[model samples]
Target chain A: MAQLRSLLLPTIFCLGGLMGNYFDRYTQSKNIVAEKASLVTTTDNKCSLGDIPSSAKEIMKFGFPSCENLKFREDYVLSYNRVHRTANWVIEHLTADKVFQRDFKRKSSMFKEDTSVPVLFRSTKKDYRNSGFDRGHLAPAGDHGYSLKALKDTFYLSNMSPQVGVGFNRDIWKRLEEYTRNQTRVYTDIYVITGPLYLPKESAEKDGKRYVKYQVIGKNDVSVPTHFFKIIVGDNRKKKSNAQLQLQVFQMPNEKISKGTPLDEYKTSLKSVEKASGLLFLDKASSLAIATDRSAI
Target chain B: MAQLRSLLLPTIFCLGGLMGNYFDRYTQSKNIVAEKASLVTTTDNKCSLGDIPSSAKEIMKFGFPSCENLKFREDYVLSYNRVHRTANWVIEHLTADKVFQRDFKRKSSMFKEDTSVPVLFRSTKKDYRNSGFDRGHLAPAGDHGYSLKALKDTFYLSNMSPQVGVGFNRDIWKRLEEYTRNQTRVYTDIYVITGPLYLPKESAEKDGKRYVKYQVIGKNDVSVPTHFFKIIVGDNRKKKSNAQLQLQVFQMPNEKISKGTPLDEYKTSLKSVEKASGLLFLDKASSLAIATDRSAI
Candidate 1:
């Protein structure tokens, strides 16, 4: 444990320093409390005007990816990327009770346009009809099975991305989602932020240049992300207020992955995800020490 | 003129209908007056805590493209795309006095990183170095020549994008900037919004897929937009309270164009630009009849 701590201390400090700068900028750009309160009052049915929803506050306890077009859902909060016709990021807070309840059926929910988004920017069912890609959920539907409304809210097209089917979305990506839900057994609370990435690769021309290339499907020209990322933070604060949290970040290619591949193969550093996605995660919570152990949960 | 109006009325009405929905969403998502007032007071050097800069109010009089990471400068307003390490869009309100008054020398200014942006998301000079692309200005420096500070503000890397050096940025793009500035001679006020686009092209693999492909330069991986667009709105309301405005939109590829090609050849419909860019232009001002004449200026 001492050896591991020695190794991880530098990374933790580095991230802590970087996040300090980011946290300042985030606060200056958007007043999170006021914005969240306003969003909850306006969009959420359970909350009246001037009343803040506890679900939104708990789900976004860490930090927001970007403060563009935000949607506060019943069980999750999302920032929509209008240009991509999909979510920039969707965040959810999961507990053992929420994941294990299974009070709702996924089959009962149907994918529909999020009318909260203007028609011009909203993704539709037709965009993915013959596009050969699945309407993959950013915030997996299984995680919000505690209530029917929560499960149905996950079906909004705004929360969907054009993800590869067969081996990727159905196989390995589903495994990741299952693994995330299972983590609720170990930690008191699990905070997860999932989003798409259009990463660059070295050009095939051998010209020493890198290019970001992605496909667009249908008339709306929805962007097919090159990869998807999930950053999971497991909080053990209920056990002891000062207990270190476990941080695990994964980046998987939006393509087929062989079965039996270890989930740890996709584990990545938080800095790389932040740099590529142009978002800062856990900035507000960086004051607390975070353990970087792969075997933690 | 009557024949042109008859042909253009449908497009205008369609855009008006579409924008009606968008304007409502825009207003709900962002209280333009409050946000602008807050942004001006926070960022502008000349303005005190409660004073809203008239410059920002005027430049963004029509509508904002996306209000993510907006930087309100002395002469222009920009929405920064942290993921791309470049400006998403920059809006500039030009007048005959501002464009014609050459108070600053181009050589006096130097391109530098925008310190206001968190260093993790900033685009540095090194990103453009040896990348075989020009540090092209979104809001042309020539238009801000009325003041040294305004000219210097244009040098911020936030306002720069990677563009083809010789044929595009130097020769053709320069001509476009010149043409935009020259328009101030004809119109009392010219509002121009310029930005990059990562438009998709039909896949070469014959898979019937469309792919958005762009190169990334240097360590920061600043995106090289596949195309660039400029939407110019000429307002003659000063002459009469309800005088019709002339609106022209152009999209040019980020590569070499034949030197003798006329600028009008790149003229495109506003709907096409809005669709490809995933942004609404002049949405708030849609109630005003806009002339679609290429020769209006």
Candidate 2:
């Protein structure tokens, strides 16, 4: 186990944990814009597990609701551990844990929500396997720097689900990640919405064993992700009845016969790190896009 | 209908008509690059379709490849126009009809390859009735200030596709656009690759339609699009190529459970225009990108 650092300087500045408290008080009695913290001190800025405890905002959940039971899918579970300011929810067996640290450049794209991300999977140990599914990784290590934990969390069997790489290997997936990173500059925090997208069992596959792979993927033929999620961390102060930045991550099945995915392409992304994660987010991009649309008017 | 300007001056400068000659000469001779104009006609440059028809090197198609036949299914159609320009290809939409105006605050980005561009949908008709789906736009108008024809061509029924907004009212969408405009000074000709993403049927709908929508979009949703292809207009040449930039837009099945679209949401999109004719060359982004990718790789 790697010893973690305890830097909170960026946390305070980045998360505005202190400001989060101030906003709580400020909104309490219309206290203007709340007390302004000219600067964040390392003291209160640490990303304590307390910050994201069970009570923490379940802002977004991917995989199955049952995965939320924690114990049910302990194998794929990534617990938040503080290495100073960085909170890493780690895994142990990524689909391709070893290929993560290379200097492979992602394709140019408008968004890279899931480029370079590690594929996760659903664990057979969790009773969610064999129904024709795949283990998908919600928290991908490929996009972020190479942290041993980051790589491991990618393989957390519980995090896996059946998924088709929408723009996988292509640029769309990488561009989405870039888009999310860009969001950090303007917003105080970012809440991401990501999950696996399953396909019908008979959509398409290779020799009935290999699934259609993506470009620029790991040793496993899984296409590098083509999509990711991004919900800028906004002040949850209002606890606004509606999600401020809700998003969805999905893997689109290849529609036409020649787009590369063979006919009889698996409608459902497979199961098993050996197969595909038979999982997908509850909704698709359109479902979550409504979150941004204000119904007030 | 608005009569388009002569565009002759730009036509000569951009080498709009010389596409055919350029293709045989340039395509056969793989070592060619877009020639830089020596004349100081620094008529401020912005993103435009001027360079597309003659610039592409490869035309790797994404999604399911279908003939001109068959009804378009938002989730079962092409996913993107992956263009490889020899080490890079800017992913963008081209129209058979000239439309859109490149208006940006700087030159570098406008001149650079596609960087960030969002997928937009323009209805083929005003009323969402009759059409089995909502008119969708692939290249959104928000990214550029194209001419009416430029904008209109983008709304070609062939250009629209099913889409879903990805975030809150996609407030981040516009912000992302602004961010791209602001970041131009830092990078230029950012090779881009953007396209439609099929999430699934009823994947996630706004009111009742499943659409892929976004707040911010870039020219090439990637850090660096691999297959690079481009063409330079030498104020002389003949137009060539038959591949057109097609926009496949789509919307979801309307749900009475949803309120009427907001008045502010009323738009003058491409779907509302009459059929187009002429030297249709604008709708050619994906094709050119494909050429660029092919020649380069």
Candidate 3:
């Protein structure tokens, strides 16, 4: 029971109690504040991708998160989730030269269906019509701006998420994209993973148990994530020996975010984002989980 | 004339051609891209304020700027400039506990005259009356909110700079203040110096030479600053040994700033802001100036 509580509650707090829908174990924990403390960070002052290996290892680099719908593009790799009709996460490797050399402007592109995904399971532009949500890019077109083909490939419905147009997509999220580009100016290289999060705010009590709640949208029943997460794995440019990676994670609400809300306010521990998303990077997944469980107990 | 051009051209490029008031020295020197390489940053991984002595020196620790008009308030120190009727810089040393432990709210206090300044040069609220500028804060009132007396002291006319009210003061500046507060969460301590800049843009070619130009406001002829700068000296919380301080400097136009503009866009090197403002900070003033001269030559 102690081991179960340790594993169950850290994941609950990591999901911020939003994962109660999947497990009743989250309902058993009453120490919400204490449990949330399980989130953590680890840093090594080295300048490489650390343990995730390289692009050549492809999808296996971060161990696929139980979802096999993977697409590897020229610049990024992503895993599509058939149930949600959105990419589980889009991963991209960015370098200073690659970002600075690009001078492309945003061009209009049709959100075409991914021929890669089965037609019956793929999301299309039709589902988003009049949904009052913007077809937000998980892997923003700006990151792929160096290549016309890469830029257009970002328009595929597979990379799109249902983002609120006004504040979240147009304002704060747009700023985050620019911030990522600017980081390239300082760091030699960085790996980025962008995805949607459907965590719940309130829990419904039913049959002496709690369940997480969220909303869905469109004919495809695409999930309207309660928040969005971006995880950055960075290599400090000055430190080239042993290739130690520094990590920073940000999770923002799916609501209106005011301008200049310091990025620090949204920064959460990378361990938590990994637990919530079930996606692992950097070779720390098993060790982080062990540490989380031990800390919880 | 060559010496003047050397000194003058460096300042012009440092201003990034924002000084159109100067001769087409900016346009003539088409190397705006190359000249900007003068911006340099030096870092020591030590965690404490270097060469500033220690906390026993308190506000005097950072070494005072040359202004004789100094205000040693309960929580902060400022070097006032009688000509502009604003502090050349408002200096504050902030810690996480002092900032976060307080629950104080912003209270409206009548802007009053500072009796400390000589009557001949002191500015008054009447000067700003019907003037199309907000009594912008150099050291934001928010930083002093912990003490009612300290908060009221911020209302003194001497601490105010003439700033555009809406977007510049109420939005971007406010965001910057909050961003500073947020930094305390990570750094053990940080020293902030906020001030205004009066640099010339678009040189006026006269008698085969150039001169800097600017505007003034109200009866007191308070010089309207073309830009504002904030320099932050931070101690990495984890590295406390030899006291290596990390530095980041920002300069912003005294104009309407759009919401969600990435902070990185406004980031300039410490060397340039020092050259533009002619104010020395830390103990690197002389060395930075020498470095600047070398880079220019």
Candidate 4:
């Protein structure tokens, strides 16, 4: 049974559940985890084609689910890239298990809470007043074909940003996806968060989604393109009391800061935060997973 | 019966079963999709305390049949997100008609090959490859708490890559896991190919498992540390006939090209196939679900 469990439930994250050294038989398999343990990961079931039924022609496909039903996993909160909670058993379906492989992996239990939490995909259909604003996805759909819910979740109002798909297809957005996934080859267990900045509601919506009118970033300016990054130190249910905690790193064209020709166009931008969370990246993130853990701080 | 099948089997790929939507109904509620399909996502089956079964406190906290063993739908592919596939029934469980709500999901039609595949756990203690290789993971475990098979598949050799886990932590890993799912959110049918780049003469091996090594990107770099990518493209498969067509993608990061800032430091480092096998991102793709629609590309 233990061996079977190991074969069935392959993972090394017992710091939250069950990680076997092979000598021991245990199945520390749970969707949400909190306790004193460690984890190890592998890609045993990474990618392979599934057996198609004789009715392969008859099997139909599903589209995305709804915003009202966008269930957020209480797992980890968004740290960098996009707004995200710890993944749930269901979100696992959004992954391309049979296509890509985890070429490399490493983790830091030494993470700390920071101000910028990257909101990846929330309910794009909902808003901040906790109103009808849709949670937009930093990532887009028509990209992930896992399910109507998973794919549609990518289309959530919260997941929305008013940008042309062609813009993404052409510039940084397209490069970003290819760079991260296509090039890096990372295939699992990553937390992300990406959302828009609110300074007196520049864009509003009826469905409560969002009106992404502009970016805080500018071109050719040294201090151009100032974006916020929130390094979530914990899970979504239990987050730091406020958004002040920040490990916010500002992004700008290097030409501005460093010596370069045609480098005169540089304007540094500033973003205000209620408070600032200390740096968490280069240290202390592993312990937060166990113990009583935490609850939406 | 069509409506029943609509609710029962959501696994068919429409583009000759290549681009069929990949969704497992059990993962998320279709009603949410019917309601908020425009944007945002609502799922009931996101990972949670409920997933920890009450029967086994140590092993199964999220709970279950000790562990859930699943057979690939006739397509051999399994959708754990908001979609699930069944022949002619939408039974949530073998014994119950209850539905499941999942956060992320992968709607698939690629399962046209195998019987139920085994989801394995943990890297083998022994590296048998003697090629300085390690059974790397293709899928990271953090993303798929939703699907046990997704997690276990990370352990498969087919998906393993020679990588070093640094800089990338669980938070990022999880985000990347979800990101990969989202990245693959397109193409009705996608064929991914990956494997080791080379076999070193004196590589280490333990328990029949090889310890693969990948270069450290930013760990040593001061100005721009951790800047590298792993990938290989072009068709490398032995073909039986010229008539056979294949979808080739740069699956994993091979030491040959997957280790540097290819885009920045190495221009012309990337390759273009002139014409991709199919349309990549079709804005509002559903309208083009049919091959003959011809609005995209």
What DockQ, between 0 and 1, does each candidate earn?
0.16, 0.01, 0.01, 0.01
**Lowest summed lDDT over 10 consecutive residues: which window, candidate 1 chain A?**
A40-49
Candidate 3 vs candidate 4: the lDDT winner is: 3
Best by DockQ: 1
Report lDDT (Cα) of residue A136, candidate 1. 99
Stretches of model 3 off by over 4 angstroms after superposition? A1-297, B1-56, B204-211, B237-239, B284-297
Per-residue C-alpha lDDT of model 2 across residues B122-238, encoded as one tens digit per residue: 111332233223333334444434453333333333333322234211333333333333333333222223223211122232332222212111221111111111111110012
Which pairs clash (backbone N, Cα, C closer than 3 Å) in model 1? none
**Cα RMSD to the true fold for all candidates:** 13.9, 25.0, 26.1, 26.1
Candidate 1 regions off by >4 Å?
A1-52, A291-297, B1-52, B291-297
Return the top candidate by lDDT.
1
Say which docking band candidate 3 falls in: incorrect
* Ranking according to lDDT, highest score first: 1, 3, 2, 4
Cα error, residue B159 of model 3, in Å, equals: 0.9
- The estimated TM-scores of all candidates read 0.83, 0.22, 0.39, 0.20
- How many angstroms is the interface RMSD of candidate 2? 25.5
lDDT of 1 by residue, B1-297 (tens): 853442232233223222322112101222321221121111100010112367888897765565556777899998788899998899999999999999898899999888766666789999999999999999998999899999999999999999998889998889999999888888899999999998999999988999999999989899999999999988888977787778888899999988978888898977677777777666446432564452342
- Which candidate gets the maximum TM-score versus the true structure? 1
